[model samples]
Target: MYYGKIIGGVLGLLVLGPIGLILGLIVGHLFDNGLMQTLKFASPQNIARIKQSFFETTFLLSGYLAKADGHISRQEVDHTEAVIAQMGLNAEQRKRAIELFKRGSAADFQPEPAISAFMEICRGQRQLCQTLLFFLISLALADHKIEAAERQALQRLATGLGFNAAQLEQMLRMAQAQGHFHGSSGFEAQPGTRLEDAYTALGVDPDVDDKTLKRAYRKLMSENHPDKLIARGVPEDMIKLATERSQEIQAAYEMIKKSRE
Candidate 1:
């Protein structure tokens, strides 16, 4: 349930007018019941409408994410098409995905209601949610660089998913370490020796004034709070990673504070 998909679906319904609205309700109803019971609860017409809305949302979100880094690269477009292919969507669904992408691209990709809908879907579908998250992280890292704005966007999405600070931090760390292998090679050096690197990873500067340092610390703490982590579906095993990162950040800030005194 990517936020882009949810947004695209809703927008598609709006464009399709009354006919689309009716279809959405019908499909939604069918989805509420098991597939075996789908026939009992919804008509073919309603099913078609639901399918339309679903694909529309998918395309919209994809387009939005593509535009997130300023311009849509050829790589991003290919990545999106790949996802659509994997979906095994029929002709109509594919058309809908394309249409949604057009609309999302036209709209300059502001993310809001789309993100909310995505979070709701995540709450209901754990495995799908995780898969979607993995895809998003991959997309974010696709260019071999994670932009600050992209990271902010992810943090906002994580919050919408009810992720506590701890959970968000863990996700951020994992996402940041995406291409790197585990073990010492991939491991960030110990904080003392690699203090500068640690600060950079945390998006902070050691030379900042105390007030700025405190502000950055608070911002990081709020974003990575444990409560937020649990909400975002972070496994218990990974929570420690976040806790440890936070401790390191706190320790660094303290060291800076002590030196300034």
Candidate 2:
């Protein structure tokens, strides 16, 4: 049996909070089942563990979101494949991601259980949690519009992960902009079409001061930096997502700068 969901479902951890309780249960269960003999969670390995949880769970939830509309569309499949290509996963890693995705797409899959573990891994890093949400939102909007089922599912996930409705709506719109911007590969901008989206993507405003705008730009870039994300335990394959996010941030920043100039 796949122990990922089993530990994710450990009921006791929910009452204990994010750090020791959840991870303790996970490591203990793994050791008890002879999955691993020794466990060391000092910085490096700990970060890797969190990263693995985040990465694997992202794919799992991606599958769930895609299947929310009852059936996964060809568009959704293509989008997922495109992302897999971008991540450049090795054969084994790719297989694992695919399996996780499939598990998430199952009809009986319950998100609440795994989500508990996800929340724990993301306990202190609000930005990281929000960043993960953004990527999931992007996946939801891959087919252009968010279906009713998809929207409802997202609301549950967002609420569980500590995002408000407004935050989810805002990210949904930005992810829509991201789809268009990335689809065009930065070459096809209709005049004035992306103005508002550009600002929203950078979390800034057209009227913002130079310093404020620059600060937002730098902070977003730093947060989504590929190397930083990799160090945080994001798999090498997911670096493409980081790179794309940076490109969008840069594109949005440049558009605003030109308007100001």
Candidate 3:
């Protein structure tokens, strides 16, 4: 008799082993031909693969975005290096990231395949997708303003990844206010931060109620949580961005609370 759960071929021996078990995490499959799906689990190898894919895509996309404006300015190059330093990537990883960036910056570089592959391997995780987009946007705005070419490139990339115009605009505003990408939606505890920028970060209007405000803050925090991303196969080394972002979000919320009181 075929059991409902995963079972061996009569003698109760499993052939697929870890591969079958890990498939459940990425694909959530079920066999119809009297065979059971592999026991549900996410393998360590799968986690590593997911992280690597994210790392590669982010590096390449960063280059592509930078070059969208006819030439990458010296300031933009410095900004890229600053971000790399902020990520705290190791020597070998940094070298590989640089290589990927160069390839994407080529005059005839193609972005569709890279975007498609990124979406596929990401398993449709919206937060990861948002995070990746967030990083690219931050890089684009690093020179204090986004040129026409940069905006068009971002819009195309955003649309290709299933995000609409509204979401992209909202993200750009929040990323600019926060000055970094960690998934949070608020500004840092910097001096003279305008209340309007705080509202923009949390993506709420001035007329929003306290209840709605808090909810938005909580949602952003959860989505941008470093531990949450790490648990879902994001590279451990990249957690620093989220960590710093958490601090900024907290600061923004605190500032909002003070104004309300």
Candidate 4:
């Protein structure tokens, strides 16, 4: 049976606590269920609109998340630069991204409008919404310091993006687990990769049955498959991110499989 809902439901519990260990599994679950077959953006114009909105909202909310802790830190700035680099954006795109980021970081910037617009555009597309939430969560945790203010901001963003607090927590955990599984090579475990993180990366409990574990692994892989994401209207730039995420899931599953054997 498909395990996406099972994984997401379990991970949702983590958003209720700090160091959320439940995020990725839920997102993986939501996307792997073939729900995206209903996508309506088949026209070039529609696809372009989705891409533009997705890109703009991403940087805007990323800026909002960065400025959540009162002041934007150098690490956050560097992280944003790294994200831009990974996207390999052209000069015009980079400029627009920078401009949106600056606007979002302004003291009076309101994220509701952008969030609402994105929500409306992606009305039936849970995968796209979750992916955007995933990106913002990554930016929020970039500094490795999730202050109370930042945490609240994250919750707000989650709610604004049509997710509940539990779902936000799940996404947070999944994002954190990615750090453990991804490095310069994109899928290499960092030094001292922990078993706990491996489990978290897959959004499963340590004591999960082998059958369930395999289902969770398959669910995540199917969810993050690049072609699947593209069909769901995820920006092309995010395909690399999704591919790397799949790598992390695979690495995590491998770790679990080895330990069991």
Candidate 5:
């Protein structure tokens, strides 16, 4: 009888190899629930920690970016609040975000722990990480300007999230090409004529004179320069976009110069 049963089991395995494997897996999982849980889902404590860390890191970084241009304008604060509201964070999360923002605005904003935690969270959920970055980009441009230091900091965060240079550059280009200049709206101007629009994209006045234009261009270039952007966490792919924007600005300046002449 034993021999017969063994023979029958071998026959079943041969007849249903995949099904047998699946069943074996299910039985094994049942027997090793602890291992399975550890491998698949984060512990409750870890989940809470991750959520807290994400909120803190995001708020801190956003605050840092807001203050990068010497002062955090009311517009920036309002924009950040809007972002916070949109995130649909719970009371605890909202409170944590505020605390982080306060810490981030301090004279010494050390981003290492936040960055590390962000990376860990991103490793587990890439989509969430991307979403967080998208929010940061929006925050950086909230005041219609991207400061050099702010851009640098953003790029650094992107890189720390494991985005390669090429990937970062691509994302930046997509962001620019999408004409996110005035938030998430589409392109609002045509080519060439977009010179003034480009200035607007950089949050500058279209009628700026040569001296001011040059100064603004220099300031923007200093921040968005490919190398500096790369150093700051801009993905390599998005660096090209920043380069293109810089070129557009130069072109606009030249056009304005010719018009003045």
Candidate 6:
């Protein structure tokens, strides 16, 4: 059996008793079947390097997106600060992140180098790459709308991250759908949550069969599993985002299931 299976099973059992073990095993199976990329870093030093790279690329690309529409708006700057605050960075880390953001926003800065460096560090881990893109997408939508230039820059970054146009669009839709769950304490549909948003959240058409819908939900849950993300080199602090993603997925699935029933 894959190490993912064993570790997932053990963690599940420890965290949630019996039911969590079954869920963890299922996720581990997905990991073994190629849903998650193989971990490349074997040493503490390499792990630290990977974490640093992830942090640097995140702020750098965020700055690039913020400046894509010519001038970075005050709203964008505030949003970026909010994101940094949510990360709960220490004094030194926050300082470094702000510096990276400024460097990326400089008129002479080119996003290609940062994108390439991040890609190399990610080693083709699709889920990790998606997580990165999700952060950028969230930033792009922070102003409540995506500008043409911002969209264009996002597309370029997506291509560099090994996603095609279609995949990026799918992620975009899912990200937008996720917005419905923001600022809410619970996962259930808040008042005014549209059914269409739920469908988009799953990245599926309403006409899709029950089995297909369930499959999409499962795939999303597996892809955003917090434990899997952390094991794959995502910083522990950042796992909160992934956990929120899982909640959104669950809420969307519940809404869709209720509608069909």
What's the lDDT for all of these models? Answer: 0.55, 0.76, 0.76, 0.81, 0.61, 0.85
Cα lDDT of candidate 2 equals 0.76
RMSD of 5: 14.2
The digit string of per-residue lDDT tens for model 1 on 89-161 reads 6798678778887776664566567756654433334433433454565566666676776667666655554
Of the candidates shown, which would achieve the greatest lDDT relative to the real structure?
6
- Error at 157, model 6, angstroms: 0.6
Q: State which candidate has the highest TM-score.
A: 4
Candidate 4 global CA lDDT score: 0.81
**Tens-place lDDT digits, model 5, residues 1-261:** 133334445554676786765555555545466555554445555555555555567788887767766788898889877766765667986787788887887768866667786776535355446545755776776666677777777777787666766666555643453352222332233343445445554445767777887787687567657775443343343344455456555554555566678
For candidate 4, lDDT tens digit of each residue in 1-261? 346655665576566542233565556566764554344456566767777788899999888888888999998999899888998999999999999999998999999999999877766477888888877877777777688999998888888877998878887887788678877766767899889898998888899999999999998888888887787678898687777778888888888888999
Off by over 4 Å in 6: 1-43, 184-186
| lDDT digits (tens) for residues 113-136 of candidate 2 | 777897776453576677678778
Better of 4 and 5 by TM-score: 4
- Backbone clashes under 3 angstroms, per model: 15, 1, 1, 7, 19, 0
Model 3, 111-212: lDDT tens per residue? Answer: 889989888776767888887888788689778899999999999889877899999999998877765322334444566568776787778887899999
Residue-level lDDT tens digits of model 6 in 124-207: 678888899998898898888999999899999999889999999998998888778665477777678899999998899889
- How far residue 35's Cα lies from its native spot in candidate 1, in Å, is 18
| Cα error of candidate 3 at position 50, Å | 0.9
**Clash count, candidate 2:** 1
What lDDT does model 6 reach? Answer: 0.85
Model 5 misplaced stretches (Cα beyond 4 Å): 1-46, 87-95, 121-124, 177-261
Ordered from best to worst lDDT, the candidate numbers read: 6, 4, 3, 2, 5, 1
- Position 75, candidate 4: lDDT: 87
RMSD of each: 16.5, 11.2, 7.5, 13.7, 14.2, 10.4
Per-residue lDDT of 244 in model 1 = 46
